[model samples]
Target chain A: MSLSEFELIQRYFAEASTDASVALGIGDDCAVLSVPTGQQLAVSIDSLVQGTHFLEGTPADLLASRLFGSALSDLAAMGATPAWLTLALTLPEPDEDWLQLFSSRLAQLCNEYHVSLVGGDTTKGPLTLSAQVHGFLPRDHRLTRAGAKVGDLICVSGCLGDSRGGLDGLLNGFENHTEAGYLLERFYAPTPRIELGKILLGKANSCIDISDGLLSDLSHILKASGGLGARLQLEAVPISSQLIATFGEESARQWALTGGEDFELCFTLPPNYLALLSQLPVPVAVIGKVTDRADIELFLRGEPCQIQGSGYDHFQRKDD
Target chain B: MSLSEFELIQRYFAEASTDASVALGIGDDCAVLSVPTGQQLAVSIDSLVQGTHFLEGTPADLLASRLFGSALSDLAAMGATPAWLTLALTLPEPDEDWLQLFSSRLAQLCNEYHVSLVGGDTTKGPLTLSAQVHGFLPRDHRLTRAGAKVGDLICVSGCLGDSRGGLDGLLNGFENHTEAGYLLERFYAPTPRIELGKILLGKANSCIDISDGLLSDLSHILKASGGLGARLQLEAVPISSQLIATFGEESARQWALTGGEDFELCFTLPPNYLALLSQLPVPVAVIGKVTDRADIELFLRGEPCQIQGSGYDHFQRKDD
Candidate 1:
């Protein structure tokens, strides 16, 4: 059935939000929300295009999962509580099956993340989805990229670059069933470190998400922190065993250091806050230290190392 | 030179904001903002595609102005104060000239509206732009579509159908110099009725923006207000003299009734609140009245009349 914009929204996106913070949701020209008193609002917007961000025939459910997973990761990096999201989706035409799967997965994710889908606009064009997320943070507290100081310890949560390995395996085909399944799952449903981000809110000096690889994302933190530098012990970077077994340790380590789309948290802590690291709900590794020097130095097993590529750039990809 | 996303944002979008509500602008995982206490937050997102929304080879500056003007009209409809915006822009390639024009016009509009360009994401794809705007409203007050009662007077701010006339002139070419210029200007740069909306905040019973022709948009307000109907006096519908001279009386009336993209405000007020209409800064026409009937009735000079088209729908345009 060819659905009008109003009918489409009424059918799929008119789920009433029970959250008290949402004074108004879908159906209005603008969504009205209540940001709790004594809290600042944090917002982030990201877009995913058909060919640029995903394969052409990627399943609608997996695409929704990955899109929202990556977008919400920004909120996770900020130590903010994800509260609401607005989606602007463009499609070449209305496909019932695709809309069903996409909206269902998106609704599921919103429920899982405790965020209400507040508003959306659907248009006709090439397949592209943009999501703007709104969240809340304590007014006095901030977890930013500019706070990492010299002598601070740099850390990352969970495994890095498994999503990259998954992409590679999906492209080249994997030999091991168990490893391929694990890698693909990670790629399709990468978790954002929201809890860990909140835990580090007051303690972590600076924070960023590992979307553009550990090296590149960490460089952003360093650069934002007044041209500071970092010394990363390559051996300390976390790599999943599945990724290492599927693609050898060398390839896995390279991906962990430079592959993009992991959605894990990379943050800095003052040496005194080391105790909080052990109390984290998720596994974390101290991979480096912030330095006064002006360049990022890499060490593998205590020996200086060099890598071939940096993180992905939208306009100028390293591989391109 | 091909620019990375970070460099593009830093060069074009990193204007320092004097707005105190913006706690942090570009150069971070997310934009941090402070919504004043005792106020509710209002958010709206809109997407414009190259082929669907505007003609190919449209000037970058004009395109930017039109996109923002149409999007901010949502905030105006809600009677909210526009405060911040996040842009997710996708481009096939980085064209310095296009970027300069687009970003410059965008900056000008942000300054004009007192809204900050807080954060943005630049990606590689077919040209598509999505903007999410955040604004603020008094917690206890609202001007919504669902509150219009049967006896309310329906009024509209500014002339209608001039943008449609402009579009027609653009496509078919116009003869009158002054009228053509006025219509083309209207088509290219729509002014969102923000100040008028704020004035209507608690006083007006219900309000909506005229994006998709008067008939279509007012129908939305009527439908949302529990299926109430309206009686529109066709002669009273405001049509600019320029549009009438250019398109003739019948065609101009039809366009005034159904043309989209005008970005004016259509609101309803109880009869007791009619005095506020004359006091409005902009010229307003009381074109209709809400009624208990379930169907819209049109009359011209006290005689029943019929119009050809209703309004614009994104998925199924009437002209299409």
Candidate 2:
């Protein structure tokens, strides 16, 4: 039997939300949520299209995981606790089997992240998924990109460029080596650094998730912080062993600098707070320092070097 | 100059939010909002596709108003005070003039409704607009569809079926008569009955926005309230003079009973609380009463009547 929109929601996503914060979940014109007295809400939205963001044949569970993790990373950048989620899922048609796996993975993530799947709308259109995540932080407390000072030390969590490498391998059809498999996993399921965000709440001067690569996202911090700039010690940039083995050190380093979809957190901290890095849940790399210069400068082995691509632009034609 | 995603946001949507509740607005990883103490958050999301929701040549400002007004109606149904909005705007390409008109109208609506344009994502894809609206209500105080009791008086705010008439006129290319123009306006910009929603709070037993026509939306209330049904007095159903003139009384009545996208409120009230109807901001019609039966029964001049095409379902094929 063909499923109507109501039946589709009832069968696949009815029980996807079971968080205490959701006073009313699904089936309503609006989902009602209870906010704690002392907490503020942090909300972010991300959209993933079939051809623009991923291949058409991508697995349903993996797509759900990728979209959820990347969206939640925005809250992680704000040092906020994940609380609620709303989705607007547009599909070309009602694919029951695809929806089953997608919603199962979504529910699992909601459980893992302790977020309530409060509401969603299912519509018929070209395949596009928009996920809005709402997180909470104590009143008047948050990490913003505008707090980086000229002397602050720039830092990043985890090795960058693995997701980009994974995308590259997927496009080129790499052999099923262990390294290739690791990169594929990175592309499919990124870990939102929520716990690390919590640890850096008070100490980090500024923070942002590395979604459009370290260079692009870090430049946002610089631009937001009164046009302050940064100098990166390219030698200190971290690269995973698997990524290096698959794509060579030179390409891996370039991807670390300019590749996108790395959901790791990049932040700035004062020199006095450097000791706090030792207590972080993930490995920390101090690769650069904020500068007064107004533009990013790169130096490798004591010599300046130029990068090829600045970052991803959804509108501007890449070649131009 | 061709605009990148960042440039487009900075140029068009940077100043869209100025509400005090927004601690941080556009240009942040997550927009931080200060939810007032003793208030719960109410959220809803709606998506409008290019071919599915509207025609290709629809004016940008009209499209913006339609999407925003319709999305906000969900909060209105819950008796929540509208507050913040996030848009996931997927466009085929960035047309500067179109963006100007669209964003200008969106900013105007934000001002008119006291809603902050907190944050949004712009991407290159098929033209699909998804809007997620946030609102605030008193803690533990909300109108749910499950609250209706059998024998309650059924009430509807404003005239219904005008939007459907408007849509039909548009699709059929009606002459530019005054009635046709009114119906077109109704189709392009249906008002959200937020004030009436506030008036219904604490008095109405249950309430919902009539988006998917009377039968379909009321059926939701019935199912939510444990299968209690309703009986409609067809003569008492309100239809606009414009709709009746544009489309004969018979078709208008049918549309009033079963047409969708009206964006009006439908609620149930106890007989003792019937006097509250006089205090509503909009005209309301008492066209029905709750019943113990599990299916809607309609009466026309004391005789049984039947209606066709229950309502719009996104996934269900119309032929089925």
Find the candidate with the highest DockQ and give its number.
Answer: 1
What global local distance difference test value does model 1 have? 0.86
Residue B213 shift from truth in candidate 2, angstroms: 1.1
- Number of the top candidate by lDDT? 1
**Backbone clash pairs in model 1 (N, Cα, C under 3 Å; residues 3+ apart or in different chains), count:** 0
The TM-score obtained by model 1 is: 0.96
Question: A143 in model 1: Cα distance from truth in Å?
Answer: 0.8
Clash pairs for candidate 1: none
Q: Quote the chain B TM-score of every prediction.
A: 0.95, 0.95
After TM-score superposition, what is the CA distance of residue A159 in candidate 1 from its true location, in Å? Answer: 1.1
What TM-score goes with each of the models? 0.96, 0.96
- Model 2 agreement with the true structure over A118-235: per-residue lDDT tens digits: 7788888899999999999999999999999999999999999899899889888654467987898889899999999988998899999988889999998999999999999998
Error of 1 at B164 (Å): 1.6
